[model samples]
Target: MDWGSIFSNAMASALGPDAIVYALAAIGLNVHFGYTGLLNFGQAGFMAVAAYGLAASVATWGLPFWVGIAIGFGAALLLALLLGVPTLRLRADYLAIATIASAEILRLVFGSVTLSDWFGGSNGRQQFANTFYDMNPYSSRLDFGLFSFSANDAWVFTVGWFLVALSCLAVWSLMRSPWGRVLKSIREDEDAVRSLGKNVFSYKMQALILGGMFGALAGFMLAIKQQSVIPTDYATDITFFAYTALLLGGAGRVLGPVIGAIIFWFLMTFLGGFFSSAASIDLIPDVVMSDIQASLVRFILVGAGLMALMIFRPQGIFGDRREIAIDGR
Candidate 1:
């Protein structure tokens, strides 16, 4: 097995665009599920709206890049409002069902034949990110012996990390304020917060909007990194993956999602590389596992690993046990 190549691939994936995208998405999930105790299972919906918002505005309507950015953010905000107003007052499970359903609905709508002209349907949209790439300063690939990134990827890497840093700072600062304390209180017990004459519904809505905005940022990064937007990209698994990252890192803490994202992708890529290499070298019998099966072994191992983590440390690496306790009332 090529251990050197395995390590290199792991390192690259740990710091790659995929990690950045999930980190941002997990951060947004932290705001909703961590700080505010929201059961938003449709985070991918928010991402989709923003991604297609940018893709349609630029690739279809011939708008400037900045306008697309505004539209994406606006769409996220609107989604938050639409989802929150109808479900926040209900039980937490209702919100979860609504969110997950809404996301799937949006995905299907975007991929529908009727909307192909505007959204490009299942084929998706491209040619919308030229303006974004035009500002790249890296001019050449950044090869650091073990791993490398193309000039365009290098640009996204820089901006993505910056956004991660900025998001963490904002979460840290907000969680220290009185408002942030209220959110924690709500997470612990909404009835107690309501007894204090605080408007619980309003706070929930604000958190939803804030978290949705973060999801939108992740969408923008994902869209610009690929310079395309496809409806299938915002599938239900995206939200689950973000949740997994959030849980692994320790939710309710400011930097938990960021660290979790790094570790999650690192382990996933490392295991995949190891299995692929082993299979290629005939270390395992073909009767036991094929090259195709080797690729999927990572998911099984990771799932089992996550199960172990939940059984042993449900709060995650950096999360407090009390933090995961949500107030269903």
Candidate 2:
């Protein structure tokens, strides 16, 4: 097996656009599940709407790129209001059910034949990100020792990392404020916070809107990086994966999502590269594992790793045990 190649690929993935995308999404999830205890399982829905918002605004309506961005953010804000108002007052589990269901519903609607004219149905939308790429400052590929990036990818990396940094700073600042303290207190016990004459519903809505905006940022990153917005790309698994990243990094902590995203992508890429290389060399018997099967082993291993983490260290690398204790009431 080519160990050097595998290691390089893993390194590249650790810092690539995929890591940035998940990091932003996980940061949003951390705000919801980690800090506020919101149980927002529809994060993918937020991302989808924002992505489609931008795609439709530019590709279908011939709007400017910046206008598309504003529309995407607006769409995310609308989604948060729509989801939070109806279910934030209910039990956390209800919020979870509502979010997950709504995410799936939105995905189906975006892909529906009836909406093809606007959303491109199952095919999705492209040709909407040229404006973003046209602003690239890097005229040539950026070559690092371990991996290299095309000029386009280099521009994305710069923008994506900047966004991640800005989001982290915002979360850090917010969590240290009085409002942030209340959110933590509410997470520990909403009834107690409510007894203090605080408007729990209002705070919850604010957190939802803030977190959904972060999700929208992630959506923008993805749409720009891929130069397309496909409904299928916003599946429920996307939200779960972001959750996994948040859990791995430790929820409620500002840097947890970012760290978790880097590690998650590193491990995933390393395992994938290792398996693919081994299979190419027939290190494992064909009957035991084919090239196709090699690609799947990484997910199985990661899943088992996640289960172990939940069992042995539910608080994650940087999370406190108390942070995971949600006040379901």
Candidate 3:
């Protein structure tokens, strides 16, 4: 098994845009579920709204880059309100039901052939990122000991990492403020926070809108990173992946998603390479696995491992047990 290749691929995923993208999304989720205890199963819906906002703005309206960004964010905020208004005060399960349904509805709408003319329907959109790329600062390639990045990728990395840093800092600062305490309190017991005179519903709305916007921002980055926006790309599976990254690194911590994304992608890529190489050499018989089965097998293994982690070490690597423990009574 080419150990060097395995390491390189693992490192690439760990340090690359995939990791950063998930980290950004998970950070937003950390706000929704981690600190606020809001089970927003429709985070992907939020992202979709933002992605299409940018895509439609430029492709249909010939808008500038900043205008597209504002449209995306505005669209996310609108979705958050629409999702939260009817369900925020209903109860946890209601919020989940409403969000999940809303997410699917948005997906269906985007994929509907009726709006294909403006939204691009099943085909999606591209070639709408001239403005974002115009701001790239790096003029040449950047290299560091066995790793390097082309200038465009460097701009993405630079911008993505900066967003991650800013998001984390925002999370850290918010968690330290009075509003943050209220959010944590709501997570523990909304009734208790309500008794203390905090508008529990409003706080949750704020958290949802804020986190959903961050998810939308992540969607924007993802679309711009590839210069495309497709409905299927922001499916519920992506939301689950963001959740996986959040949990793997331990939720409720500012940097948990960042660490979780690194670890998740590293393990996923490295294990895939290792298993494929082992199969190529017949180290593992076809009875056990094959190269063709590697992709599915790695996820199965990770899922089992995560199941075990939840059973034994529920708080994750950097998480404090007190942080994740629920006293939902």
Better of 2 and 3 by lDDT: 2
Candidate 3 — which pairs collide? none
Between 2 and 3, whose TM-score is larger?
Answer: 2
Question: Would you list the C-alpha lDDT of every candidate in the order shown?
Answer: 0.93, 0.93, 0.87
Candidate 2: where are CA atoms >4 Å away?
A: 321-329
Residue 32's lDDT in candidate 2: 95
Name the TM-score of candidate 2: 0.97
**What would the TM-score be for candidate 1 when compared with the true structure?**
0.97
Q: What is the lDDT for 70 in model 2? A: 97
lDDT of 2 by residue, 1-329 (tens): 78998999898899999999999999999999999999999999999999999999999999999999999999999999999999999989999999999999999999999999999999999989999999999999999978999899999999999999999999999999999999988888899999999999999999999999999999999998989988889999999989999999999899999999999999999999888778878997788989889978999999999999998888899977764575322
How does model 3 fare in lDDT? 0.87
Model 1 per-residue lDDT tens digits across residues 157-183: 999999999999999999999999999
> Over the full model, what C-alpha lDDT does candidate 2 score relative to the true structure?
0.93
Steric collisions counted per model: 0, 0, 0
Q: If scored against the real structure, what TM-score would every candidate get?
A: 0.97, 0.97, 0.95
